[model samples]
Structure formats: C-alpha cells, structure tokens
Target: MKEYKISLPICENDIDTLQAGDYVYLTGTVYTARDAAHLRMYEAAGRGEDLPFDIKGSVIYYLGPSPAREGQVIGSAGPTTSGRMDKYTPTLLDMGLKAMIGKGRRSPEVIESMKKNGAVYFAAVGGAGALLSKCIKSAEVIAYDDLGTEAIRKLYVEDLPVITVIDREGNNLYDSV
Candidate 1:
C-alpha cells in the first residue's frame, strides 16, 4: 500500500496522489465531526452563519468515541459507518473540504462531488478499536463540547492506517474489490 503523511488543509496534490486501496498514515491535525456536528454545520450554513472551522482540505473523521481512559488521549477510537454523513458531505465538499475519513459506502452524490472537487474518502478499519486508538497521540474537543462524544475534536495522530475508498477520479474500492 502506498503511504502518505500529510498536514491538514490537504492540498489538491494530496487528493490527486491517492487512489482506491492506497494506505494512509495520517499525522498532524485531523478533526472528528460526526452526524450531529455535520447537521449543525449545514444548519448554520442555511442561516448564513460562518462555519467554525475552515472547510478547505479538511479531513473529517466519522466517529463518536468513548471517553478517554485516564492518561490516554482517546479511547478505542474507530471509524463509524460513512453512510450517515452522506447528506452533509457534498455541501462540505463544495465548501472546499478535500478529504473525508470514515468507513463503508457513501451516497452517489458524495462520490460525484469527490470526483468533481478533487477530494478523497478514506476508510479506517471498523471494530478495530484497540488498534485504531493506538494511533491517536492526543485529542481535544474543538467545538460542540456539549455534544459529548459527538463533539468535533482536533486529534494528533501517527500512522493512522486507512484505505482509500473513493478516489478523485470516482473509483470506489468497494466496487473494485
């Protein structure tokens, strides 16, 4: 598997280099933004409010992790199903987001947006909690703290293994594999 470790605000070059089945060992900052947070973002957009975080080239991880164990940065963090965020994704992509990190299939609209916008979707292993959690070096909630585990968090990670699910060219790993 081809490996890449990129900083946030991942550029078009980062998206272009990824293909279905490539492995990514993400480092630097990544944000956790699941269903609730996504809904709020869209709602804010509809109301003409500015988004809390920059959407450009931001990688959103679909997760609602359990509270971290004492002395640990996270607890058993792993990818949730990607389908739940399908509705919000295309809108975010249009806002300049470059990549998404989750698991399982996404809607066709999301895939099309990824292709047109030069974005990519990554799939982390589902149910591999212990393995996945090991990659997180630190984490802190950046927004929506009252949403508890669903809050958006900035995470520092290393070698956080993921498989490319959708490429910029519209290829899907699920269909090909």
Candidate 2:
C-alpha cells in the first residue's frame, strides 16, 4: 500500500493514482452527511433543485458529531456505516462527488458507480472519534441543522487520516482481507 497526502475538492487526476489499501491524509474541505442528509440531498437532486453545497469535486464524510465541549472545535466525530447510504451513493457519484469517508462494505452497484465516475472511498477508523475530531480545524452546520448531529456540516480539516477502502477502479481493500 502507498501513502499520499491530498487536498480536498479532489480532482480525477488525484484519485487516479490511488489504490485500495493506500493511506491518505486529507487536508481541505469535507462535508459531513449521514443517512438523513443523504436522503435529503438525493431527493433534492431528483427534483432538479440546487443542493446546499456544490456536488462537483466534493468529498462527503458520513459523520454525526456530538456537541463540542469548551474550547473544542468539534466533539467526537466518527464515521457511520456506509451501507446505509448505498441507495443514494450512485446518484451522488454521478453528480460529481469525488469521494466518501465511512466504514464497512459498500454495495456492488455503488462500487461500479465509483469505477464509472472515477471516485474513491476512504475509511476512517471506527471508534476513534476523539482522535479524529482533532483533525477538523473548523466546523459549522451548512444545512439541515434541525437534525442536530446529523446536520450537514462544512468542515475544514487538516491531515485527516483515512484508508482507501475502494479505489476508482472498483478495487476493494475489504475483498482481500
């Protein structure tokens, strides 16, 4: 496996060099979205409505952070099960979403969409919420704030660690393990 340092609003060239099992340290913007947020986005797209954020070249992390404590930018922010968003995944990929960060396996259809779209999938280590939050430099709810922790947050992150669970070519690290 290789290790790479990449910035967000990722382009196809940046993702082309990656392989499943490669380690990545991402710096730049990433939007947080869980199941509720995904459903909303998907529905919005279906209606040909504008999304809260631009979908092109964006990375979406499936996270629901807890309320922050004093002096903290964010609270424990960990990945949620990715499979829950499988139904919405393909459409998002088609809409120009560059990558996704979460845990667990993805459906075959989603993997195929990733291959077709030249996107990648990264996995944040589960149960490492506190450690992960340290990478987030700033966070603010951009939409769906009523969902609280499930809100879509615009976050600025630096050196946020993740592994390439599935690369653009439909290569899956989980398959070999």
Candidate 3:
C-alpha cells in the first residue's frame, strides 16, 4: 500500500489516489464533532438554517477531546467510535464531506455513500489520545459550546496519522486481514 502526506480541503484527486490499507499523515484543518454535535447539525439542516461551517471538501474527525490542560492547544484528542455517527454519515457525505476519521468499521450504506460520493473513511488508533493530542496544533470551538467537550471544534493538525479503512471504491482494510 502507498502512503500519503496530504493537506485537507481534500479534492476528488486526493481521494482517488488513496485506497484501503494505505497510510496518511494529514496536515491542515480538520473539524471535530461527536454524536451530540452531529445531532445538532442534522437538526440545523432540517430547520433550513445555515450550517455552522462550510462542510464541502472537508474532513470530519469523530472526536470529543478532553479539556486542554492549562497552557496547551488540546488534550487527549483521540478518535471516538465511528459507529455512533452511522445514521448521520450518508447525509453529510451527500453534502460534500470528503473524509471521515475515527475508530472502527462503517456500515454498508455508509460505505456505499463513500463510493458514490468519492469519499473515504480512515481509522486512527484508539487509546492513543495523549499521543494524538501532540499532532493537533490548535483547537477552537466553532459551535455548540454548551456541550462542553462535546462541542464542535476546529483543529489545525500536522502529520496526524490515519489508515485508510475504506476507500472510495469500497475496499475495506478492516476486513483485508
């Protein structure tokens, strides 16, 4: 498998070049939103309101990091279970979300959406929150602040590692072994 060092706001060409089992180091901005933030975003969409941010071509990280320790950018910023976002995945993908970073396998319909939309799913090692935090250079709440740690955060990351779990062609690394 090939490896890539990519910047975000990923385009079709970027997703096309990746495949299941390949590694990636993402440098650029990525958004963080766990279950609660997703629910809010879904509701906001249903209400015909503006989304908190432009999602097109963006990568969403399924993370709800702990409060940053004093004098730090973030703390223990690890991926959460992606299954939690299954119901919301296709809709977001349809709206131009190009990639998702989280832990665990995705559902069939989600993979289909990835195929039809030319998106990708990536897996970051769970339980490596402390180490993961080191890659996040900055973190700021963009919306839903009342949820505290569950709030949507915009993170600027450098060399944040992930494995392509499912490629646009529906190849799944999780089952490859």
Q: Give Cα-based local distance difference scores for all models.
A: 0.86, 0.95, 0.92
How well is each residue in 38-103 modelled by candidate 2, as lDDT tens digits?
A: 999999999999888998999999999999999999999989999999999999999999999999
The better candidate by TM-score, 1 or 2, is: 2
Error of 2 at 31 (Å): 0.2
* Candidate 2: residue 73 Cα off by (Å): 0.4
Candidate 3, residues 116-157, lDDT tens digits: the string is 999999999999999999999989999999999889899999
Steric clash pairs (candidate 2): none
**Model 1 misplaced regions, further than 4 Å:** none
Instruction: Identify the candidate with maximal TM-score.
Output: 2
Best candidate, lDDT-wise? 2
TM-score of 2: 0.98
> Candidate 2: what lDDT?
0.95
Model 2, 70: alpha-carbon shift in Å?
A: 1.8
lDDT minimum window of 10 residues, candidate 3: 42-51
Model 1 scores worst on lDDT over the 10 consecutive residues at 1-10
